[model samples]
Target: MNCEATKCQCGCDQETDQQKYEKIAEIIAKYKNQAGSLIQVLHAAQNIYGYLPLELQRFIAAGMDKPLAEVSGVITFYSFFSTQPKGKHTIRVCMGTACYVRGGKKLVDRLEDILKVQVGETTEDRKYTLDIARCIGACGLAPAMMIDDVVYKQVNPDKLETILAKY
Candidate 1:
């Protein structure tokens, strides 16, 4: 693959579409006959391709000798599987009771405005994907937010910009 044309999330080296398919095919061959291995295969596919698009899902279905509906159903059933490409970084704003009462809605609104993308949408530049979380278990620090795995406590609209800049 031309690294100059498309860069993978890992930022090491990008594989051509053909190479990606071959790798996934090999994975399918490894576990095709294993009962209840669809989820595992899907997980590996997502890890390699980033997100499970309809086309890739179709390919996987055919390779695994499963119906498209079964594959699509699994993808939809799991929130972790995404049909669209995700941004390099994911930002989740907590919206639990404590957070909501502590200006979580305000933070969501501010993030929408700042990122120019609504909840579950990625920025145009693909730098960030915005999401809403029920809670991040930081009730004591209400209005908490997380960028990837790092949680920010007592987040406020005023600090959103600075927090985003660090990313």
Candidate 2:
């Protein structure tokens, strides 16, 4: 299957999402003769598209009269930027010193078992992606994990079964 198709198997049109590319094009046209439009266009494009694909970057580069290499360089340099699509649900485990000492590793293990996927991998259904971060500035809530933007604090191995059951 071409998962990259602009339309899904159920005939759900994703052109609404692709329309974001056209919106970017409009923004580019508006700023076609302006200076420093590269960064501005990149921001608008990323905002609309979620992530900047190579083709979008090329379009922006051409619109701004900039080289693809320069646009590519800027995209690569920013940690906030991404080339890949993100999962619907983002699961982040905190491996900070406090969380780590408070059974964070065990929590991670349990999550892996429940999700049937290793860290940094998406579930087979593409609903969730497991990620590990060094810290989330939540030392007060040690042994923490986050699903989407909701935080699960003081997580324990035994709670894994019940926690996953809700999902």
Candidate 3:
């Protein structure tokens, strides 16, 4: 679906990274002037570039005739808008009260050791990024962890070895 926004008259016709920037601008132009077009443009841009870099944000703002602060605000307000590139796999360890009391901290530590990267960091191979979450709404399955979108419940330190092998 074309994003509904008004196109600005910014001169983005140039070579180099600007070309890619203009390409994203064209997609935004299609959705110009439409209500709720911000998300659509952001989604389209991210889909094309993997992540929403600051340069692309500036380009989009200029092409859409929106303020840079407005564009930045929308980007920051939405969790779906990622400013950094994401890894192929995302591992989230829940550290809620129930999970923590159930040895969730040990599980997170195990993962960090095995992955050779700390929480909130991607592996050197870019295969995985480890993150610690407050809760995943899986209290019944305390000490839960999510690999990508699949929730693994009742995780223990011993299970880490087997799980790491699979990935």
Candidate 4:
């Protein structure tokens, strides 16, 4: 999405960088002086700006009076936190023991081929980001995959394209 172009990737009016900062600042103020509020602040920040870039992380560190290392540490420590921009839809393939044994790797390979993006990367059009999950607790549904929050059970490589089209 081009922030300077007036509309977001979804064609909605885009929020300026300054406006995003203001919102982040408000989030910081709301949680300031409260112990163990950094996670909440970071979550709000990521939601407001999509991802936590270094510059924004610095801004957050300064606003919350936290060391940059501390803020960055939290981001790195959490798998859910991303330092790069994410796609409109996130596709996570389950790679647990059951899923992997049932052809999880095939799913990953097919996605990489179709999306033209490796794991942990987003498509050029930002339509999707490919990822892997250790487990989604759907062992009974081995070879499962998830798009956004929807779980697809017993998925095979051949079914990926049709499933993705739904998004």
Candidate 5:
């Protein structure tokens, strides 16, 4: 949740994010009028700001002398890059053939209903972010999902509330 007292509603302190963005801007400036630094700069920016919004993307584009279209294209091309804020806890649902066939989508639906947010979105309280992964590899244990680093194999959609409560 955002601290209403802080000027920046983001998780990080306002001054700290300013320092970080300034440093990142410096890095982007190094590649001014250069090419092929879009990916690297976006990666660094995401690392610092968690996600890239239009304002920040504009900042990066101007700093690196790259077109906003090019930067936005790269960001959209890669599913790994997120334009929206992620929650404190990330929940990934596997959608591989095995898992899909074994009720993975159902589990995702259950999670969405429980959290009241669609896939790739964070709950209003910023407690959890739901994501869909092509495969989390545990095919043998089909219908797998993970919260942060902990993997839950053979998840039961009916028990999501109990399972999530442990977190």
Candidate 6:
């Protein structure tokens, strides 16, 4: 799932906001004429643009020949779709039973305290985003968290400063 492209395959890195809108128009044009392509087109749009804001939602709805309300409904119903922007780096703290029992919740609290950003929020500097994951499939490394793509195992409050400092 890694992209080695010099341009950054996510497209969020190279494109300015305006340029992203331009590419979004092309994405819409490519799939808009087809039937039952709303979800797929939206996926591509999200990939290119990072997240779907209200205006972006309206654009996509209009492009796909869908009602704005319907598009909004679909986005809100799906956890995979974000209505806000993400940060350059994302941190996911596991909240599953295993992780929670091992101080994962404390880690979440400490993150909020340290970053002054709550779960599901991006830091003011836009360097980091905080998220809560049900599980990161690392029960063996309970109290684990993932920052960007790096997993930190057996994390504790004492290690938070050191871990975050690496970024």
lDDT of each: 0.91, 0.80, 0.82, 0.92, 0.87, 0.88
**Residue 146 in candidate 3 has what lDDT?**
91
- lDDT tens per residue, model 6, 69-162: 9999888888888897898899999999999999999999999999999898899888889999999899999999999889989998888989
* Deviating ranges (above 4 Å) for candidate 4: 1-14
State the lDDT of candidate 2 residue by residue for 58-117, as single tens digits. Answer: 888898889899999998888666665556787889999999999888878888888898
lDDT by residue (tens digit), candidate 3, 139-162: 999989999889998987987888
Q: Which regions of candidate 1 fall more than 4 Å away from where they truly are?
A: 1-11
Tell me the tens digit of each residue's lDDT in model 5 across 25-111: 887877765667788889888988889999999998888777899889999999989999888899999999999999999999999
Question: In candidate 4, where is summed lDDT lowest over 10 consecutive residues?
Answer: 1-10
The list of candidate 6 runs beyond 4 A from truth reads 1-13
Give me the displacement of residue 36 in model 3, in angstroms: 5.1
How would the candidate models be sorted by lDDT, starting from the highest?
4, 1, 6, 5, 3, 2
Query: What is the TM-score (0 to 1) of candidate 3?
Result: 0.70
What TM-score, over all chains together, does every model reach? 0.87, 0.72, 0.70, 0.85, 0.87, 0.87
Which candidate comes out best when scored by lDDT?
4
Candidate 4: tens digits of C-alpha lDDT, residues 1-167: 35664335555667877788889999999998999999999999999999999999999999889999999999999988899889999999999999999999999999999999999999999999999999999999999989999999999788889988888
The 10-residue segment of model 1 with minimum total lDDT is: 1-10
* lDDT of model number 3: 0.82
Identify the runs in model 2 with alpha carbons over 4 angstroms from their true place: 1-17, 31-34, 105-121
Model 6: pairs clashing at backbone N, Cα or C within 3 Å: none
For model 6, state the Cα shift of residue 94 in Å. 0.9
Give the alpha carbon lDDT tens digit for every residue of 141-166 in model 1.
Answer: 99899999999999879989999999
Note each model's CA RMSD in angstroms.
Answer: 3.0, 3.9, 8.6, 2.7, 3.1, 5.3
